[model samples]
Target: MTAFVLVAGAYTGDWVWHDVAAQLRAAGAGAHAAVLTGMGSGAPAAPPGTDLERHVRELVELVDEIGDPEVVLVGHDYGIHPVLGAAGRRPGRITRVVHVDTPLVQDGATALALVPDPAVHQALAEGPAHLPPPASREAWQRWGSTDGLDDATLGRLIREAAPQPPATLTQPLRLTAAATELPLTGVLCIANGSSIATVQSLVELGDPRFQALADPRITYLELATGHWPMLSAPDGLAEVLLASAKGEGRRVTRPAEGELPPHLRPFLLDLPERRRERVGRVDLYPPEADGPRPAVLFVHGGPVPAGVEPTPRDWPTLVGYARYAAGLGVVGATLDHRLHDLSAYPRAAEDLAAAVDLVRADPRVDPDRIALWFLSAGGLLCAEWIAEPPPWLRCVAAAYPILAPLPNWGPFEPRFRPAAALGRAGNRPPIVLLRVGGERAEIASTVEAFLAAAEGTAADVEVIDLPGGTHGFETTDRSEDARRAVERTMRAVLDRLES
Candidate 1:
């Protein structure tokens, strides 16, 4: 029987781990998760003046009672400090310790004292009192992930926060356990991810934690959710940690060296980072199901760097493109490109070319069955990449493509007025350019310029003139046109492949 010991973080108590713990117990693991004093598990927190030495001790006492010399102890968030302290003191007791996106203390320290920020100290002073009232009773809910709690469990959450005793964080200890080699698992929770700046603000001292995990030996799992991994991705979280404990399945070896995980997320595609050196590191999306598939190199317009993994919002994602390619087998990917700004050019086009290189290099992506799915400014960049003509690319499908930016920059424009932004249309790629157009004459002019450039240049140009469609016709909040757009894009890409 694998004995389990669980601990909660911050104001949360054992309540958070109820779902996960039950599952572990059922798996024949002797699971025992306890509430910290002044925390959850039905214990009220100590007053601010509670003795640090006496209170922090409850952890060791609890472990000793568990009777298991070797236990898998889980320390979530602030709970890590006490759990590790107890683990270090009784090395024989803790077989393994799992930190779910918890902070790694530089010097063994407690939560409050380690904060190091006066703003936090001030916030702690005003503390839970000054916090805004939750919109509903569920506001006080202890979260493992958004998915962790159902209606019954959520209704039972305690409304008030436990008083944080600063002594826990201030007293640093030397971890004598040479067994520090005990496995550490990190859950990278990216959902509801605010800017990196915001993440740093909360765990300012956690910079070293990120640096340490670059080693492959450390078991790190990424759940495509938010900071509250247990809430949004409870199953994903449980699956990773519990699975890690059981033993990781043989990860099918891929040719590409792994990347900056959290920063990249899911945009990971199947390509060696070295091949597209100019593009730096990219996230490739491989086909999810077992089937040969038509492929597309997706380009999205963003001044900020796109992450490596696909986010939930990246709907009709790389995998979606692969899955929906007119029942034709399709593997797809999107790439991150460096950019100064939107109005800026040349840089975006350069990044698109790098994406093309990535697609061509991926073994699973049928080299000749690939297309370009570009939106808005991305369409402009795609047009530019086509000019260079990566050997593998076969077709292009652009959505609200930006062309002749100077002349036909808006809803109104004459159809043949030199395409406002066609300054260098002649230098573009010779592949087929499939444009989904609207009623706007500027789009017409843009199409005309693209057509004129391809007139005898061997670049096949096809236009789907959407009746009464506007610049952002199908991309709006899923109107009938949006449905049609998805269907049309799917049909067109498939037709190109099937033909």
Candidate 2:
């Protein structure tokens, strides 16, 4: 049987993995949950001084006891540190490593480095070694991403949680090149607000805490649930974990049109014919017209790592935009570029070029009248095309895109700098900016800078400020304000394409 070892975060014990362990066992695997030195019934009187080495040693010992030549190490939250450290020590015995909503710490770095804020770090550091459960059931529900926990599960969880050692949070991780060589997967819980947006910013900033994820061997898996998937989404988490262990998590397979949300069903159409093999896939939405018709390529913003495969849940907004374009009598295709961290940059541009070529060659598409609609990070790919317009490329639309990079996230690439390219471009296709009113300060500033750069350009530029709409307003926010912005932006794009 396959051996699976599970580790829980600080202030928690093996009980947190009860459901996942059970699921693993039923799937014909030998599952074991490691109870750290100062946790649970293992040693109630043990002080909170249990440090990193103890936890790593305990994990290594557990693997030895399992008597398996290899095992998959699954860690939740802070558990990632010890699990990674143990894996480094016994690289040959660790077949795979999985981190659930926890960033990997750099060698000689404390896991607390992953905390986004220093205040949170201070709180965790000064707290009692074995932190107590939330004061009341209501507070527990209100705590970070635990709102999804049912009453029964919450009760069991409250009873089982033990105060963790403060040393565990204080100790730094010690890992070498060996840890990076292990097959790694990150299961991000989106409901906790740990979305792709957060990961993108981290990777762009070159944050050391996320270095492991940025490596070529790591695959990203997303769960749209809360922080603790074991209690909130055990079955789903189990399926992903099993897939990771079987080394299938990185394989890319296009989602069937039927598998998409009901609202996206009507816009489905066959892909454009290609002479040679294509670099990426596109979800086509042909217009209702019989003869050739004007078409638009819809690109969604994502800093999906270079080699990692994007799951269906990864880009739902792109589907919404493609369908919206089709509704306006324009053929639309949503393209998925190479997303791995190793291949995303210049590769995305190549993919976009290939997509444009495919659409131009399609008999159903009007090659000379094609337009480009880019959203978020997708705008980065448009710098070159916009700077040097193709005779057939019509207009270009950028919706709440980060036209420039933030200090935290440096430039994507020198050529991918949209703001710089805007100033250098001569007369080209008309450009439209769909500015969101409620965008975050940093991103909004970048958009503002781009708008400023476009002011003196020879190209005809238009900016429509979408009032009361936040970032991703079209797909994520369902308010009347968001609805109006979507309608206005689509109308703007349609007018430009027809003009």
Candidate 3:
């Protein structure tokens, strides 16, 4: 029988793998769910002193005790850290490494460093060493049921979930190129179609952590479920594992021709009118019409990754939104701003200004009928735009934008606060806030704060509540409601410019 060692991610334990393990066991394979020391029930919470080496030792010890000459190593979430480290330490003893949900860590970098958001670090510092689930019971149920996990199963999972020691995330992994040479399979969960696109894009861009994914020995599988496939879609996950055990790679189901509506192709790479800026490039997608078209300058979220060059995968989203706008009858242009590490707040604000000037100067664009579409973190840079409302600007649209600073995002300049700007600007533009209904608590608070500050201000603030929309609704949520919300948002922007 082929032996499998299963490692769980943060706030999880062996119990989470019970269903998946049983399926593998019934298939005549010996499967052992190795609960990391600081996770699972009765396990001592790992302290700040606990590091990746500690978990590496535990996994290596477990493999030796399994008594199998070679084992298939499977890791989920943060478990990828230790699993990869162990694979580096004992390459010959492992047949294949399967990573689910989380990417393999880069050498000399902690898992925490890879997370783009600063808020996550804040939460870790303020909270307990072992982190618990952030969502409520209802939210968990809502997010987990993408694969139809029943109420009873989800409840059991919630009850059994534990606090993951923060140390697990903060500790850097010790890895060499040897692990990349091992046969690898990636079982992607959550928004599986786009997730595959993202992974493939990362591979194409030569991201160090995902560079192995491009290797001929690596295979990709999509579970089409939530992040926790073990609890939600155990049967599907187990089947993938069984096939993987035989060195079989399942064919990824490709999206049908034109399945993604034409309107959603605003950020298509093939869009015309490209120019290079100092920080990055900007692509302009003009309306198909002949005369001067109303234009909108788009800004993407992220202080993305520091020190890494930007690639198509870096801003597939902003590219898409820009395409969507142009397809709807306006000149849509997407801007790639300098990363936080390379440039600070005002620099991004300056880049946005330059993109606007470039788009306005275009003979095909109407300078008087321009607007701004800011997504996520990019919305923060719009504080200056809001504070000093331009005369020709018609409106400002933001989708799930982080309007307020939780600090630590450089200087909290007055321009960082949009609400205050809305109140002071003599010529406030109509603002359309695309609020995601199912947003998390922290983001929800930021949204409410922005709205409250905008109250009684001169700005004509309009809130478009996208029911059932996730954080990155455009790319992630394909529900009818979300699609309609996106369509409505584009029409509003185009109509404002055209009028």
| Candidate 2 per-residue C-alpha lDDT over 1-499 given as tens digits, one digit per residue, 9 for 90 to 100 | 5788988875577877788889988998888889778764564455547788888999988888887665999998778998999999888889999988776667888765553333445567566555454544544433346636788877877777665566776788889789878988878776555555455445533334454445567777777677788888988888889888877654212224346322223222323331222224766777666888888888766665444334322344666666667767888777777644523768878878888888888888888888898887677777887788887777888888867644323224667877788766766788878888877554676677777777756567778787776666554466666666667777877787777
Task: Please report, as a residue range, the 10-residue window in candidate 2 with the lowest summed lDDT.
Answer: 261-270
Q: Poorest 10 consecutive residues of model 3 by lDDT?
A: 261-270
In candidate 3, stretches whose alpha carbon ends up further than 4 angstroms from where it belongs are: 42-50, 114-120, 123-154, 192-194, 205-211, 250-336, 339-350, 357-367, 371-498
State the C-alpha lDDT per candidate.
Answer: 0.51, 0.70, 0.71
Q: Which ranking of candidates, highest TM-score first?
A: 3, 2, 1
Q: Which pairs clash in model 3? A: 266-323, 266-324, 267-319, 267-320, 267-323
lDDT of 1 by residue, 1-499 (tens): 5676777766567767777766776666676768666677587556654433544478778878876545776776667776677777777766667766554554455566433224445655653332222233333322223333455544444353454555544456545454365666555443322222223222321233344443344455555554445544555666776766764522211124443222223321222222111224344555444645557666664333334224312433333443344233465566655543433456666666666667667666666667777754455665444544444455667765655442202122232122222333444332433354442433445566666766656455565545545543332324565555556665766677656
Cα RMSD of all models vs. native, in order, equals 16.8, 14.4, 9.1
The positional error of residue 419 in candidate 1, measured at the CA in angstroms, is: 30
Output the better candidate (1/2) by TM-score: 2
* True-structure lDDT of candidate 2: 0.70
Quote model 1's TM-score: 0.44
What's the TM-score of each model vs. the native? 0.44, 0.52, 0.60
Model 2 misplacement above 4 A: 41-44, 115-130, 136-143, 195-214, 251-499
